[model samples]
Structure formats: structure tokens, C-alpha cells
Target chain A: MANGTLVLIPTPLSGQPLAFSHPPEVLSRIHKITDFAVEKLQQAVHFLVKTGHPVPEYKMGFHPLDKHVTGEQLQDILAVLQQGRDVGVLSEAGCPGIADPGARLVWLCHSRNIPVEALVGPSAITLSVMYSGLNGQQFAFNGYLPVDSHRREQTLKTFEGRSANDEQTQIFIEAPFRNRELLGAMLELLQPETRLCVCWNLMADDQWVVTREVQDWASASLPENFENKPAMFLFLATPRQKAVSGKKSARSKSTGRGSRTTGTKKGLHRKRYNPD
Target chain B: MANGTLVLIPTPLSGQPLAFSHPPEVLSRIHKITDFAVEKLQQAVHFLVKTGHPVPEYKMGFHPLDKHVTGEQLQDILAVLQQGRDVGVLSEAGCPGIADPGARLVWLCHSRNIPVEALVGPSAITLSVMYSGLNGQQFAFNGYLPVDSHRREQTLKTFEGRSANDEQTQIFIEAPFRNRELLGAMLELLQPETRLCVCWNLMADDQWVVTREVQDWASASLPENFENKPAMFLFLATPRQKAVSGKKSARSKSTGRGSRTTGTKKGLHRKRYNPD
Candidate 1:
């Protein structure tokens, strides 16, 4: 019987080594496996070398997404599994099978009943949610919106409608070049008071996570060099209610049931907004 | 200028040894940090001792959430902070201000502009998302849903509507006793075809992470022993599209975009359902 492959090891973000602290241990275990698939052979080699634990001897199976990976490369990976050798897969950064290009391979592994174990680690998605201060309970993460204006607008409208009724938080990302344009479109289309958060260069020394009202964002002049920067955007469906002060009144019910309330609050101001 | 009086340190889930992780290093940095606002004073003390670190000679401040933390105890924490002494806030598990009980204090710090720096460590949210096989680009982490049937239903409906139109993923949690009940409710109220991923006892020896269709879930009865177990629930807005087979034909378009047409073959008996 063949040993199951463990795929999807996440690497740390740039300058944020602590995000995924388990990769080293995971890599060590991979060395004991007979075969291994890596997103980028060179990058993986460098990582192993830097960590002082290079793979001694094993079959190298590069994934199709890697520059060195090809149809033949995939076959090599499958052949290793067929030979009953345990296989391990690792991504270049953060989590595998995310925006990263390891999904197809992982899916193939899943279909084959290969045992896949994903270790816990840091992810930009969770970090962004933690700092956004938006509704965390119900959120949808839409990956990079289409570059085309028509498709982009359609995507934005779709998210807008989703957040219209419930206090759902909608998450999306855009290539740095199109961020400003996307923000502008959001300002024009989304409810003026909808809450929006932008987390840029997260976990790095220059990380910036800021939340503001959509209208406030619309009115601000675009930064001069707004192109080519990686960024994540979070939009809250319901306007954050101002936090209540003072003691609970006699009329305050403990049932904790609350309805959706809406109103336009002016430009980004830090205040507690929990209608409940 | 008075130096910042607040330090936010993230503890591990199992309260394991720190070794050389970021949390302990941050804990050692405070020069005048006299009072430590810990969730569990005895556990924190035991952890500090087990890590072979010198027990700080400073006074200990415990939060009310701790077995001994109370309103009066919180006032003690505030008093120490007001006296210009740095106060370190630690949670019983995972990172502070995230699904943990330190957020109210963090809010107090934010309101007062008391500088707050969060050190990194193990986070269940980050771990769960890493394995969810859902869109990671945008997500919301609603801590735990209300236990009441009406309120819980209302909250679920609100969350469901948020991701209906986009590829956003929504995440929520429930106490151990209500896990099966909540899962049952979710299967009924959510789109039957929506994909659901559940991570139970994350990072522990018996950890289980499963992503399955809701309909598939409805057909089977879950074991009752899961009550009181810590579990994280992730619902993707849509099922990811399968990759195109290599034999598919590529069609050229006038708009310079190429389209691939492939015939779908039925092989595996995988369930088909739209998460939306």
C-alpha cells in the first residue's frame, strides 16, 4: 500500500517569518518522504539550504505551475505516488492552493484519495480580517477582480448586493495598478456609508491596515504612485453602529435579537458602531 | 512623553512551551512592564516557569475573564496602566483581540490611544483558513453564533445572503454541544449545494478538517460525541471550478481572449451543489 501524500505547506510572508512557523518541521518531515513536489525547485532548494536541512536524496517532482514544471513533471509526481513513495508539496509563500498556483495539483491529489494534511499557519486573509474591524462573522473573499471594466463592475455590484441586507463583510483583492480605479468604482456604486478597509503590505514592516467610509475614500485624491502595489480590500454590508455608552436601561432586552439598521455616516471616524 | 503602557502577546492553543517563538521574546522586552494582565495567572506563571525564563519580579495583574478576573480586578489593571507602568495582556489561548476575550481591553486601549503592539503566534482562524479549500482572497470571521434558535437563524440568514452573489467565504463557530445542531441548521438554511468545511480540534492530535457538500452532510448522521469540542466552520460562496482537461479544444476569440471547450465526463460520484 502506498503512503498518502501530504500537500499544501505554507511559507512565511516576506519579512514576516513568524506567520507560518511550522514549515520548517513540515519540511523536515518531507525529507523523510521518498518523493516531494515543490512549486519552485530553486526556491525550495534555497529555503531548505537557508534552514540548514537540505533534502539528502529524493525524487524531485516540480508542480506544473513552476517554471520548471511541465506535463512530464506532473507524470514524475504521479509515478512517485504509484511507486508507493510518500510525497510532500510546498508553496513559495503563505498557504498553498490559495491565490498561489497549487490548487490544481491539490485537487488532483484529493480526487485520488491521497491523504492531505495542511498545517496551521499565517494567511493574509485571516490577518486582513483581524485588522479590518468589520463584521467577522459573515464574510466572503472574492479573489482578484477581472481587469476588464465590465466584468469588474459586475463583480463589485454582486458584492454590493450581498452586503445590502445583512451585516455581511465582502472581501476582494486587486492588482496594485487597478486599486484606485476599483476604489473609485466602489465609491460610486456601493452604499455611501458602507464600511471599507484596505490592508496593504500586511505583516511586513510597512504593513498598513486602515478602515474608512466609502464616501470618504471617494473624496480623497488618489495617491500619485498608486500602481503596482499588492492590496486587500474588505467591505462591510452594514454601517458600523456607534458603540453604546452608559448603563443598560430597563427597556434594554437581554434577548440579544437585533434588526439591520442603515444610515449614512460621514467620512472615516473612529467610533464604536454596534447597533445591537 | 510617556512610553506605551500596553503589550499584546499571543499564546499558543495548548499553552505549550514557547521555545524560541515571538511571544516570549516580546514578553521579555518590557523594561518597566510591572503588571501583567493575564487571562489565567497560574497558567501564565506555570508557562513562564516551564520555559526556563526568569519569573519577572513585577506585580501580576489578572483580567476578570480569568478564573479570578473581575470588574475590580480590571480596575487594578487600569490603575497600573494609568500610573505609566506597562501592562502586558495575554490570552488563555491563541492571539489576543481575536476570538479571544482581550478585545474589550484592546478597545479600551484604542479609545485611549495607548500604544498596542500584537505579537504573532498560533491562531485557529489562520489555521482553519489554510486548510479550507475555499477562496482566501476575502473572508469574514464571525466569532461564535448566538445559541438561541431565532437569533441563530437570523444570523445564519444574514451570513448566507452576504456571499450569495460573490465568491466570498463565510466562517463561524459554535460551542461543542451545539456543533451538530448548528451543522444541521446550516444544512437546511444554507444553499444545499454550498460547500462546507469543518475543522475540529485544530492543532490537537485528533484534529480533523473535512470539506464536503451540504447535501452529502444532510444524508449522514453525525456522531454525538462532538459536543463541547472546539470546531471552526467555513462556508465558501461557490464551489471552485474544476480544471480543464488537456484534451479540450481551445477556441480563439476576436477580442483576443481564448476560450477552452471541454466535455464533462461522469466518473466519480461526487455531489453537485452550488454553495451560493
Candidate 2:
């Protein structure tokens, strides 16, 4: 029999309703996998149940691979595939392995020559940048920064510097409780012209996606309702394009492709962001 | 009347079946959006039609926003929302604006203070890294590298340097026709220790995902089937952990959180690939 493949499953971002972030097809895949390796056993079971999966009907079983699982144990899990029975590795929330704990198992699969695949689903980090209107062509996902105020500020400096230096958009997430501190650090460390985009509690009904220059953010404050909610933040310091000059009528920015960007002279008066 | 929000829709990666990448809710959204601004009008119509939408019954209308659509015209599309009607922005393939053209409309919506929401779908770039088992804490998506052989080689060198220097996973895509040329450049330019991962025709039935050190890649050849398919590539050069050492019965690398890597005296035999 052919070796069974290790499927990488994606879950909803925290606070997001499961179905809101995935399609029926993704759920169908969940229904098919008989065995799973997840961070929190109860949470994974909860997800399957919530997504309309009949756990007993599918005869699904959960195997723990949180921080405690040993490499030896993961290897044993690999034996399931070697035995030609498919198994899945689920990230607690969002796409597994990108700032999540399932990466080790994916790597282990590579080492053991097991076929690996990742299912499509919601990715908060990617969606945040896309909505930010920042330079999406080149961007980095810098997971949580240091807890120390001084180090956190330094980290922001590096990201801001990269944003200016290579025009790479910098994306980072913060612990819900530390949200205010990071925003304070960002306002203090980022330059006035630096653009900051924040998405509060993505995929929730109360989701808020907004972007503005640091200078524009001075007088503004986040709504009281958004405080302590998990958020994704993006900083972009890439120089603004002079497409507003009206010199090039049918110009194309790097990713614009077939879109003609003939900026009408009137557009120059408005705040337009042109990322090259 | 309240304004309708602009929905930034995600299409399946080229060659991926629609249902495989989206759920019924997304299709429902498409069913409701009577107005659309797409990279290719014909393609978008065909997409909806193929997905079982009665285009005429939905009373949908297409407004062109191809390479020739001026910035002024995009603003006109935004006006559709201001008029209390929702408009969908569709990409030719994949998510619009990330690696495609729908971004200008999204940015336009933001500049005008119109609400923007991104629908979730497959992202070949993120999926590649998740499966690569590289450090996901930080990564950059460098859209398309230089096309000239020498320039492309130089670009690859910089990416390899960054991968080694900061352990940042580097992702770049190649035009289908130039796939072979890019692969050849990657092999010839990268150091033996550099890790290269390629996922061909992602989300398609024939997709293939694998990673190997450059040296190991030398002994292997891509399957004949992958030649002209669109592909996502990743290169990671972080220092290899010696956890493969036999001293411990089971040990995990970094994500193990509470565990300390003491650089055990027992761990130097592994074929470590440090990109630097």
C-alpha cells in the first residue's frame, strides 16, 4: 500500500467563528482524517464538533503534540503513515507552523520522507497586510517581540528600519494583554510618516481594519471595545510613489499587472498610497 | 443609507478547482455581489458561471479594471460602494494585490475611508513555508526575482545571505515559462548548504512539495511533470539543530518552549546545513 500522507490543517484565528474562516471543503477534509495531532486535545475536539463534524461517525482520534511531545514520539506517529494510515497535524489556531507549534512535526515528516500537504484557510497575518494597502510585494512576519520595554523598542526600530531600507512591510502580533504597550512603543518608535495598519479581532463580527500615518494617529484612539482583543499590526515606511505627478498615465507598479494606474490630477489631492 | 463594504475576494490558485479553495459562504458572497471589478472580465464571468452561478439570474454586471483602468476609474468603482452597493474585486488567479492586480482598488477603498475586508483562501507562499519546517517566526515573500540570469543569480545570493544572517525564510515565485531557468539559477548560485523547497501546481491534484539541501538537490531531479507549472519556492539557511543527537531518547528543537538547547557535546555528527 502507498504510504499515507501527513496533512497540515488550518484552524480559525482566535475568537473567530470556525466556519467563517473555512469552507465546506476544508471541513470535509477534517471529516476524513481519522487521526490528528494537535496542541490542545480538547480544543481540537471542540473545533471538529463545532465545524459540524460527527466525531464518532468519522471515528476520529486525537494524539497530543503540544510542547510536551518528544521527537521520539513524533517518529512513532510517523509510523502511522508508514503503516499506510493517514494522520493530520493541526495548529491550535490559524495555519499550522507559521507562528504555531506544528512546524516540528512537518519538518519531521520531511526527514522521514512522508508526503505532506497544507489545506487552504484563513491566515490573519496575510489578510492584515493585504487590507493595509502597504507594500505587500516584500514583507516579513515578525512574531511576538521582546517583553522588556527597551528590547521591544529596539525590535520596532529594526522593523521600521527594514520598512524604510528595503521597502519590506513588517507584520507583528502582540499578546492581547500587552496590546496597549506595543501600540505605545510603535507610536514612540515609528516616524511620523510611517503608516500603521491595525486589524482588531479579525474574522469576528466586530472586526475593525484601519490604516493611517503615525502623524494621523496622534489625536486618534482605538475604540474602548477593541482593547485587549487579539490584533495584527503592520508598519510600512516605504517612500510614497510620485505617481500622483500625472506624468505617467498608464504606469504599472510591481504587482499591478494589467491595471493601468493613470492617476487623474484630482487623485493627488487625496491621500493615495502607491507601493512599488 | 449605510455604504456597502468592498469585499476583496480570493480566487483559487491557477489550476486549482474553485471548490477546493473556497467554501459555500464565499460562493454565497459571490452570488450576492451584483457588481464586480476584476483583472480579467471574461475570466471572472467564466469563474462564476463554472461555480454554478446563474450569471444572468444573479443580474451581475462586470466593470473592467484591467491594466488599462485608470486610477480615476478605480475611484469610480469605489463610488459603487458609496452608492450603497457592494462590489467584489476579483483577481485573475490567487489573492488580488498580493501577487496580483486587485490591490489598487483595496488601497483606493482605504484612502476614501471605505471599509475593506479580505476573504480567506489558499496562499501558495504561506503554505510553502508551513510545509518547509523552516523558522516560521520570520519570513519574507519576495514576489518575483530578476529575470536576467546574472541579475537573478545576484538576487538569489542576497536572499540566501538574509536566510543565513537572520534565519528568515525566503520565498519567491517564478513565471511558469521561466521555471526551469530559475531552478537552474538556484542550483548554480546557491551554496551547498542552502535549503530549497519547491511546490509545483499548488492546490491542484498533481501538486508536489519537497525540500532538500542544495547538495542533496544535486543528486535529485524534478519530476518531468513539474516543468511548466507555476511553483512556489522557499530557501532557509538557519543553523541546523543537533537535536538529532542520539544521547536523548526524544528531544525537540525550538518550539518546545521550556526546553533548553545546551549544545550538548554529543551532537556534532548530523549533516548540518548552516546557510552562512
Candidate 3:
């Protein structure tokens, strides 16, 4: 028998409800799905109930499909699909299968010739790139850069090299706790005029996105609460942005030093650029 | 005075109704906004009406924003922000500021230090990568490949090289009309064992997404209706998938060379791999 369809369901990036980000049509599909392959069972159940999807009172309604999902478990899940029950794959955040363990199921589906559907939803990667105001035409998302100091520097240099050659914006993310360290390295390693965009807490009420040159951000102090928070970083080596930087320096010279203020009293902020 | 935000609006990717893709909350935002920067005025008006958004009967509601949007016009649009009216940007399809003219305004917003908001929505690039079953952890969206034959070949080789180096998936798009040509080049130029994924017409009833190795696809033919239709392609050079191919070759020796059948005359069809 042909396998049942595998649906890749995208969950909320933050605490917002499903309808706040997903279409009515997408929600309808979720309502009809019973079998779910999820990273976190508790969060998945919470999401399903909050989104108004029918879930049985039994704890077995959601199947855990984390990084540890074994091939035998995948086959066991496929056996359910062979019986004609559709399954939904849910990631911990954002889109399923991208930078998530759900890709294993997607890969299995391809191998078994099972049908698959990827529902559209909020992807922080794409959203960050869009708001970065960089090269939207060409860009690369290097999910998580190396954590080691030496390897991280080499990777950053590699990204800068690729960006200059192709006029492509390079995007990468950092663990919540390591954002401060990552920001410091970027300021020290990337070229002085490279345009950088840093975004924190997307899709929430306190969402903030800011872009500036590395040189201007050298002396900038990050927000007090941003020490351990999810953030995205993007840098562009394009000619147009470099031109913008040139125009900005001219404007800064006329307005006097330390006149450009960028911080706020709110939780998410970056202080004025006062590179001495 | 602070400027009103530059909102990033997402449009439907295919023939689906606007409500079928955008959440009610996102639509509400569209209903209240009067200022807009859109690629096509007629399509934008049509989309707004279909989703119950309020648009003035007057023709001036939509401001033309294409590749030709000028600096003066961007400044002209920025004037609306100065008057405390938030502006919505709509691409012809998918998210604004991504592979569209809306980025110019976004770039301007970042340059002028105006606030910007990118709402959560559908993005074809991410959707394709999610379905590719490749290395989603690290991927590159190369936008449109070069039109020149030699340049296109070189780009594909470079992508394959990178994918091999870091296990990064390389994604690129082509004009719907050139998909056949592009696929041909991919199978011919890319390594025989490199995994290739092609996704066409995402989010619609007729959506199709398929992933297989380049060798298995060598003798395959594209669907008849695939000509001149929007599509995304992704490939990865990784050890695990190569292992899958090796196991498949052994299975082929036992079952037969032309036994891999993958399609049905269903809503979405993925063709078979006939390696004969």
C-alpha cells in the first residue's frame, strides 16, 4: 500500500498563538491531522490545543521525533502511515526540517516514496534576511557558525570572502547565551565598513531589528537584557551599502561625533556608536 | 518625529486566494494600511479585495515598485512615513523584500533609521530547502542562477564544491521557462551521485516536490506542465545520502534497474526514477 502523506507543520517562533502567524487554511489542515512527529511532546500538545486541533486525552497522541529518532522508530512511524494515517512533523521552533530533526522523517518519506507537503509559515531565517536590507536577490544562511574561537574566526572570514565575491548577504545565528561573544567577534573580525544587521526576539511585541556598519558599532553597548536571547546576524559587502556607509560618515562628520543615538530605554537596545 | 514602520507584506505564491495563505492578523494589518509599495498595482488591488482588505476605489492607492523604483521615488514614499502613515510593501509573490523590489525601500528604511516590521509568512526558498531532505542546517539560497551558459555551469560547480566542503546544501532558482534547461545542466554537469531536489508550484493544490540523486534522475523526464512555471532546486554533497545511493544500487541489482516508481495521478505527483 502507498504510504500516507507526511505534512511538515511550522510552529510559532515565539509565544504568539497559531492564528497570529498561520493562515486559516493551514490551521484547518492541522485540525484533521491525528498522528504527529514532534521534537517536544509537551510543547506540541500545548500548541495543538491552543490552535484548536483535536487531540486525544491519552499521552500517546504525539510521537517524539527528536535528534535521537532511530531508524527502527522511523520504520515504526512509517508502519502507521502504511495503514493510511497522515502524520505531521513539528519542530521546536520555526519551520520543521530546517535546522531541525524533522528532516530525518522527510528524508525517510522520500526514500519510501511517501507523499509529503510543506505548509507555509514563519521562518526566522527568511524574515531576518528580509529585514536585513541586504542583498535579497542572493544570500546564504549558515545556520550556526562554529563555537570554537579559531574555527569561528575562519568561518567568519570565509563568509566575508563569499559575500565580497558575489554581493550576497551572509546570515548566521548564535546560541542565546553566546550572542554577546559572537557580537564581539564579528566586530573584531569583519571588515570595518561591512553593513551588519542584528535582530532580537522576532514575532513578539518587543521585537527589534537594527542594521549598521561594523565600524560604527565598535563602541556600541548591547541592551542589558540581550545577554541571553535568540538573535540573527547579517553582513553585506555590496557596493551600494558601502556607498551608504560613505554617505553616513560624511553626515556624521557634519553632525559632530557621538551624535548618532540608537539605544532606547526599553529592554531591547543598542547604544550610540562612539568609537574613540 | 519618529517614522511609521515599513511593513513587509507577503503575497500568495500561486493561484490560491490571499486568505488561504495569510493569517487573519496579517490581513488586518493590510486592511488598516493605506500606503503601499507593490510590484503590480492591479494584482495588489485584486489580492487586497479577495482578502477583504479595504482599498480606496481610486487608482492611486497602489504605488508602482519594480526593479526600476528610483531613489527619488523611494524618498517620495518615505515622505508618507514622515506623515505618520505606515507603508505596506507587497511583492508579486511570496514575501516582500526577498527577490523583489521591496528591498530597495527596506534598504532605504535601514539607511534612514526608520522602524521596520517583517511579518511572518510563506517563503518559497525555505519551503524548498525543507523538502529537499538535504543538509538543512547549513544552506545557501543563490537566487537566480546566471543566464549565460558558461557562467551557469561555473556557478553550479562552485555550489557543488561548497556543498562537498562543508556539507552545506546549495539552492538556486531559475526562470520557469528555463527549468528544463537548468535541470538538464544540473544532471549533466553535477556529479552522478549528488542529491538533487526540485520543487515546483509550492502551496497550491497542484504543488509538487521531489528529491532524488542526480544519477537516478539522468534518464527521467520532467512533467509536461512543468514548462515555464516557477520552481526551486537544491542539492547537497554529503556522506549519508551517498550511503543511501550505494544501498539503492545494491537493491537495484536484485530487483531490476527500472523498478523505482514514485508517482500517482494525484493532487501532487513525484515521478519515477528509471535508470535504464
The candidate that wins on DockQ is 2
Model 2 regions more than 4 Å off: A14-18, A57-60, A225-227, A240-276, B54-59, B66-69, B240-276
Point out the higher-scoring one by DockQ: 2 or 3: 2
- Residue-by-residue lDDT tens digits, candidate 2, A14-118: 556655577777788877788888877777877777778766734776677755567676777787888888888776677777766666677677767888878
Q: Mind giving the per-residue lDDT tens digits that candidate 3 earns over B81-199?
A: 87788988887777776666576678678777788988777788878877877766667766555556666677678678767665667877666666788898998999888889998
| DockQ, candidate 1, vs. native dimer | 0.18
- Interface RMSD list for the candidates: 11.6, 10.2, 14.6
lDDT of 2 at B79: 76
**Across residues A1-276, which tens digit of lDDT does each residue of candidate 3 receive?**
667888888888878866678988888888888888887788788878877766563734567786666667777778878888888888777787776666667777886788888887888888888888776766777655555676678768877876766666788776666778888899899998888998887787767787878888855557788755578888876343332113222322332212110100000001111111
> For candidate 1 chain A, which ten residues in a row score worst on lDDT?
A260-269
For model 2, state the Cα shift of residue A98 in Å.
Answer: 1.5
Per-prediction TM-score: 0.69, 0.84, 0.84
Tell me the tens digit of each residue's lDDT in model 2 across B155-202: 677678766665567887766666677788888888887778877877
Q: What is the DockQ of each candidate?
A: 0.18, 0.24, 0.20
lDDT of 1 by residue, A151-241 (tens): 5666677666655444456767655656677777777777777777776666566665556667666444443555545577888755334
